[model samples]
Structure formats: structure tokens, C-alpha cells
Target: MTKLAINGGTPVRDTYLPYGQQWIEDDDIEEVVKALKSDYLTTGPKIKEFEEKFGKYVGVKYAVAISNGTAALHGASFAAGIKEGDEVITTPITFAASANCILYQGGKPVFADIDSSTYNIDPKDIEEKISSKTKAIVPVDFTGQPVNIDEINAIAKKYNLIVIEDGAHSLGAEYKGKRIGSLVDMTTFSFHPVKHITTGEGGMITTNNKELYEKLKLFRTHGITRDKEILYNKNESSWYYEQLELGYNYRITDIQCALGISQLNKIDKFLRRRREIAEKYNEYLKDIDGIVLPYQEEYIKSSWHLYVIQLELEKFKVGRREIFEALQAENIGVNVHYIPVYYHPYYQKLGYKKGLCPNAEKLYERIITIPLYPKMTDKDVKDVVEALDKVLKYYKR
Candidate 1:
């Protein structure tokens, strides 16, 4: 008989393993403590230090640190001049923030179908979705896999549209030879705990354009400008500042920047461990008839934010939810990456209907995000593999 954990058999793991987690060290703690003891906690020296360090890391000329990833998205959208009547093209298979930023500026979000294999936005679909009102493209690097930047750039150039890359899952990722933050007009990153590097909660926007860089700075701090050149009045006082345009008070604290600096220092180690875990999953689950592993292209290096597996229902007697529950019974904390954004009731209320993007809808039905993090040992990976194997065998058709 095929042993199954849900049937009261011994689980593969005695302890629960979450899908993802932050790996904090003593160094991280020390940095936070140092920041806490310093004279300035918010809008301080560490902010500049962290921004400069991050800019150098990503090979970008400027970086604007913000309160969180969603605020980073909002700042990027504002810098791109995405406003009323403008439409931003993006994929449906991403977090809601990717599209919501457009709405924050009174713009419409045009959903594009994803490439079935890479699970990134298809450039062809992007071109097909462009209308007269389409002003920008917000392509997400879903699961740390780089989108086809070359094609996306060509499309943007042809239509004179801005490109804002959502690099939330891709901090150390590279496409061809260029880093993710360097290739786009503007790229946004998140520092949530589950991400590669944690600043407790923070985000940043990286850009090569000086004008956009300056605009992002103003946008992050309530559109206030103390710069002499752009001020409407000749206020020579150092304390005098003016609100140049409407913006948000989305400034990140120095404490977060200190933690970010510490986390950034160990990014290469974090990336390497994540890749190792992904490679192990590839090796062990390659031949599993009912499982489809993530596709990685040779030209791109993924950050491996999440190890997603697709279930082939034809080879299984049970459904996706059943498998999910079985994995949970085995002490594995599996989760879904996303539901198609337009399928949400809130989105549906805005006149978005089903069949908006069939590929993304299909993906939502089959995708499962399993445990993958730097803290996991080889034994942990093996346990997850064994549990998955048992569950699949028990439910095989």
C-alpha cells in the first residue's frame, strides 16, 4: 500500500516547513541595533549610504528608498507620468500591486497574457494590447525569472512608452549580461521579510535617468523640494522648502536602511543557496510524471524566490487542492503564488470580467509554491521531495 500522511502514517517531516522565510544573522541584528542607537533614525545618513551601496550593486546611477514595495510602484508610476486616461500594460499573473499602482494614478491596467513556458509576459501579447491610450509597460519578473527585456524595449520604443520593471522577486537576477535594475528605464524592488533581503519592510526604485531620479526623490517625500533651481520663490533659507507637485510621504526609515545594508552584503550567499535548492528540486523531481518544474532559460539567471511546481491533473486521480492538503498533512507549508488579478471581486466590480487572460487563469488553477529558502538543509529538501512523492503515488491514476 502507498503510505500517505493524511491516512495517519508518519509524515515525512516532524516539523512544519514554510514556503519561504527570511534568514537573519547576528550581523543583521547588530546593524539594526547600531541604527537604533544612532542620532538619526529616519531621513538620516544610513539612507544615503544604503541607496549608494544599492545603486552600485545594481549598476544604476540613482536609487530612491521608499516605505514599501507598493509605494515604490506608486513612485515609479508617478515618475513615468502615468495619469488620468493613461493605460499601463502588464501581466495578470503577478501580485495586485503591479497593476494597482496604475489605478492609484487614475490610469487603467490592460492585462496581457503570459508566455506559457517562461511564465513571463509575452512581448507579442504586449504589442497586441497597446492602444492610443497606452502610455507605459509594467513587466514583472515573476518568480525572479527575467522577462524578455530586449523585446519589451523594442515594443516600448516603437510606441514611445515608458518601461517600469517590477523586480520585487529579482534582486540579484541577471538577463544576458545586464543586471535587472540596470536594464530598464526604472526598476522597483521590495524588501519584505519573505524576499531575498529584508529591511523589515522597505522598497527602492533604481534608474539611470537623472530627471526620473530627481522626480522619484520628490515623489517619495510629499513632492517637497529644497533644491534652489526648481523652487518657485527665491527662499535662500536652508530650512525653506516647497511642494513642487502632489506626492506621498513614503520615506523609508534609517533603521530599515541599516538592516538593508547588512542584508545586501550577504545577497550573493543568499542567491547561491537559493539556486542550490532549486537545482536539487530539479534533480529530484525531473522525471515525476505529474509534476512540471519551473522553466529556466540559459541566458537568464533567476533569483529563485519561489520554487513553483505545476500539477498535471491527467496523471492524477485527485485534484490540486487535494494534493495541497496532503502536503500540509505532511507538515509542508505549500501555497499558491497568485490568483489572476482580474478574477478578484474588487477587480470584477471595475468591469474586468473572466476570460480577460485565459493563460493566467489556467496557471492559477495548477500552480503550487513549495518550500524554498536559504535556511533549508539538504535533508529538508529531501524530506519535501519524499513527501511529494508519496502524495503523488497515492493519488496517481
Candidate 2:
């Protein structure tokens, strides 16, 4: 197996301390193993159990589990009634799925600028992008930090728009004391290995609207409904089902849901450890003149999924690439969170250009995601800080 090396000669502290990782304990393994032993492996009791538990955890009335985050977004978009020629306002400083889901539904994605401090979608910019065709606003909770949901909601209300929060990074995050999943009309979560919790590969959509919830249930499974009561007026019979609309087979297995239930048990501990690591990074990097630490807004509680630091280019001798490579030489495992969504080839083909979102474009040039997860120890954190400090000193202007 290949190993990541540090400075050519020095060995990395841990060969597997990725930027983010799944913290699977014995319980998580046991749950999955137990599910495998059960008669129902897919579309079983555990899947519904996990959905109900997750819904309560996030304070949402309904939760629909799917194959992955992108599927969750697609389902949510479809349930929200997004269609061809519709426009959706969203931030560019996010994973492409936030915008691509719009395109998947034959809708146009209008890029919005980000907040300079939190790097979340700025509501003002979202408002400026709205038009007659605007249908929804999908604000990503970047790096586990909750976007300004109340402000975003105010804008959405004024313009009669739907809010589908891309909460892939914010399963346990809160905004203004309310959990993130409950704040918007719909919220999508990722259970990828790098997220706050993991189910190997899964996603979920949460909503309070019963109609939308029903629609999501159908959309996640080929729009087929087996509800006997809904299918027949009085002569409800077995084997009777209805294919109400078009949908996808985005159902997740019970094995994954079992693991998700197990992981949810330790979410508090996981979030606490992640925050501890983030605090350590903040303490160590606060005095560094050329680094801009992530700032949490007063009303939001972040899940600390990624500890991103932005470089002050004016104070650095080299650009982002040079610093990123230097960190890699030290086995720091640093990476950029995202390039602006509009900068992608597909979006450019749709008439998007540079300078469309000035704040997002500016952020792309400076931001880098440092190592962050629940398993890192104090020694690991110190080593990362020391390595970063050394690299910056060697390249300082």
C-alpha cells in the first residue's frame, strides 16, 4: 500500500488521518453485522427506525432516507416542484451538488455571493439574484457552519420562494437555537464518510410539510406507493400498488440505516471532539498574520466538519498552490473546500463567467481545508499547527 510521506524523509504521524473520516466504533460494526444476519437487509424495519430517530434528532416532522446526498437533493428539488426553466438561487462556495441538483431538474442555478466572514450564502446577494422565474434558494451549510437561515427565510418569504438547505456538512449544526434541519422548508443531509456521521453512503431529506413528505417518499422509490388505504377506496387488496409519478430507486439498505442508528448514538461526542480540534486550530493560528481563521456567527453553532483557513495573499510570498504543496510536503493533508460552482465547465457553458460572485471567487483563491475529525488527539493537532507554522515561516514574504 502507498503511504503519504512528510518532507521526503519524515514519516506521517498516522497514515490514515484524512481531512475527515468516519468514526465507527464497535457498536457501529455490531449493528451492521446484526443487520446482515437479519432476514430483511434492504427496505427493512431498521430503515424506518433510522428515519424516525433521525427526524426526532433533527426536530423535523418527517425524514426520508435515500441513496446519497445528491439523491436527497434531487428528491427534495423534485418534491419542491422545481421544473424546466425555473431558477434557483444558491451560493457558489459549495460542493457542486447544491447547484447541479437544480440543473438535474432542468432548472437554472443563479450563483450568489458568500458572506465575507462565514463564507455562507449572503441573503442580500440571494435577493438580488431573484426574478420571476426564481423558484427556490438552496443555501449550503459549508464546513458544518449553519447559514443565516432566519435572514434567508425572510428573503424567501418576501419573494415566495422555497428553501432547500444543503446541510451535507451540518447534521448537528444549529442556527439561532433551532436545529438546521428544521429551519428550512426542506433540508438534505449527507451520510458520507467525511461527514459528522456516516452510514457508509447515505442521505436524507427532512421536511415538516406532510404533502412534500409524501411526495418525497414516492420520488425516492420510483414513485410507487403500496399504501392500501390510498390505493383503494374500500376493497383494499394485497399486491395492489400505484405508480403515481416518475421517480428513482434511491432507497438505502437497512444495513446502512443500522449503522446510521449506531453512529447517531455518538453524535454529541463526535461533535464535541470536532469542536475541540477546531478550537485548537484557532488558538494556534490566531496570531499568524497571513492566515484568516474561520469565524462563527453569533447566532449559529457549527458542527466543525472542516477547519478551513484562508490565506492572506498580501502577506504571503507564494500563492495558494505553493502553500498547499508545502503543507502536503509536511503530510498535513490540506485541501481546498471548493472552487466556485460557476467556474465549472458545465456552468460556464450555461453563460456563467468570472466575477459573477466576487466574494465566492475571492474565497476560492485563499481557502484551504485542514485536517479535522473526531479521532485526532492533542498531539496530532499540535503537530499540524507546528507543521503549518514551519511551512508559513519558510514561505513568508
Candidate 3:
């Protein structure tokens, strides 16, 4: 018998290796410390600095910083004019927030199937799901791979619908030689610790349209604007401000923005390291019998966020659960990237049932997100591969 960790044998690693992590250094801390000592903590200079830097990086005209990625999505949904009786189409394979943003605006979420090869929402599926009520398409850049933006854009133009790309995993990704944030009507990003850049818990929406940009700003700050030009009553009074409409307080603090600015400065280096790690994984894992590596489109340059691998279930006697446990038993913190959005209990109660997205539902049964991050050492990458190889070999049919 091949002694295995899951069956009480020696584990491959002494400590657990998490699936994702952040890389923060002295400068990142110093930036936040500077903001902390400054007069403005919440709405301050660092916020604008970060926004401008981010917009320039992504080749966009404006960027609105907010509390978190979900809030970014909600802000975009609001800016897109989603309302009662509206329908938004998105992939079921992404985080629940992708679909939940529609619900936040009193709009119905229409689930779409994914392309099995790329693991992104298929344009064909989006087209099939469209209706007179369909107002927008929220395509997720699943695992840092940019979705087929050109095709999706064509569909949106045909239907006169808005495109809000969920680029939470694709901070530095490019599509057809252009940056992700440069495309579509609006694009949203997350700055969670595990993401490419970390602001602790933050999000942003980038856009080229001035109307959407202004709307996003309003939605981020309780719909209040101090600008004399737009306010109903031209208030030149220094203390005067107006609540133009109903909106949420999704403001991101200067502290987080300070960290974001610092993090953004290092994003290229971080992106390179992430890509190196991903390339290392691909080089070693490609020929592994039971493992199916994630496919990359030739035209899109991926940021390589989550290195998800799908099990060729027929190659192993055991199921995904057994293999997942076996990997965990070896001190590897492997995780599943997502459950189809509609599978959650809340969505289920909303009458979204199973079989809503056959491809995504099928994918959920086989996918596992292994560790890949900028902070990981070469040895850490090797350890992950060795652990996977051992576990899969032991379970081979």
C-alpha cells in the first residue's frame, strides 16, 4: 500500500499552505501610517491619489473607490439603472455577489451557463437568456482570466444593455492588448487581502462614461454631493450639501485607500510573481493524469489569481470529497473556487433551483482551487505540486 496522509500516514508538509494570501511590506504599512497621522482619515487625499493612479493604470477615465467588491457591484448595478422588473444576466460560477447585486437593486438575476473550457460566462448563454426586461450583463473574469469581452460587448450593443465586468480577480489582466478596466460600460474590482492587491477590504469601479462615473460617485457616498453645479439648490455655503437621491454609504476610508495606493505601486511586481507561480504550476501539472489544468485564451493575458484545477473524475476511484480530504490531510489548504450562485440557500428560496446552469453545476463537482499568490516561495509551489501528485497517485483507479 502507498502510505497516504489521509489514511494516517506522514503528511507532505509540516504546516498548512493556504490557497491564497496577500503580500504586504514595510512601505505598504508606512503609507497607511501616514494616512492615520493625517487630519483626514475617511475622505482624504489618499483616496483621490489611489483612484487616479488606478484609473491611469487601467486606461480608464474615472475610478470610484468603495467599501468592498460587493459594494462595487451594487454601485455599478445602481449606476446601470437597474430597478424593479429589470433583469441582469451573469454566470452562475462566480461568487454570489455577482448575482446578488441585481437583487440589491430590486432586479431579477438571470443565471447563465459557462464555457467549460475557459470557465467564463459564455456569450451564447447570455444571448439565449436575454429578454425585453434584460437590462445588463455582468460577466465575471473568473480566476483572473478576462472573459470574452469583444463578443460580450457585441451582444450588449445588439440589445442596448449595459456591461459591468466583475474584474475582482483580474486587477492586471489584459484583453486583446488593452487593460480590463478600459473596456465595457463599467468594470468592478475587489481589494480583498487574497486579491492581486490588498486594501484590507475595498473595491473600485472604473468607467469612461462621465454619466456613469458621476452616478458611481453619488452611490458611494450616500447620494450626497457638495458640488455647486449639480446640487438642486446652488449652495455656495461651505457647509452646504444635498442628498440628491437614495444611496448607500459605501465610502472607502483614506486608510484603505492609502494602502491601495501603496499596493498599486507594487502591482506590476506582484503581477509578475503571480504569473511566475502560475507558469510553474502549469509546467508541472499539465501532464498529470487526473488533473485538468485551466485553459488560457491566447488573446487575453491573465493575472492568474486562483489556479483552479478540475479532476478528471473517471481517472480516480474516489470522488472529489475524498481527494479534497486527502490533500487537506497532507497540510494543503486547497479550496473550491465557488458553488454556482443559485445553489445557495437564499437564492434557492428565491425559487432558483438546481439545473439552472448545467455546465457550471457540472464544473462545481470537479473543481479545486490550489494555492497561487505573489508571496509564495518556489519551494511552496513545489510542495503544493508534490502533495497533489501524491494524493492523486494514491487515489488512482
* Candidate 2 per-residue lDDT over residues 227-274, each given as its tens digit: 865664446567667888899999999999999999998999999999
Candidate 1 similarity to native, TM-score: 0.98
Cα lDDT listed for each candidate: 0.94, 0.89, 0.94
Q: Cα deviation in Å at residue 128, candidate 3?
A: 0.6
Q: lDDT (0-100) at residue 178 of candidate 1?
A: 78
User: Looking at model 3, which ten-residue stretch has the lowest summed lDDT?
Assistant: 229-238
How far out, in Å, is residue 103 in model 1? 0.4
What is candidate 1's lDDT per residue for 235-318, written digit by digit as tens? 579899999989899999999999999999999999999999999999999977799999988999999998899998889998
In candidate 2, which residue pairs get closer than 3 Å at backbone N, Cα or C atoms, i.e. clash?
none
- Give the CA lDDT, 0 to 100, for residue 298 in model 3: 98
Task: List the candidate numbers ranked by TM-score, top first.
Answer: 3, 1, 2
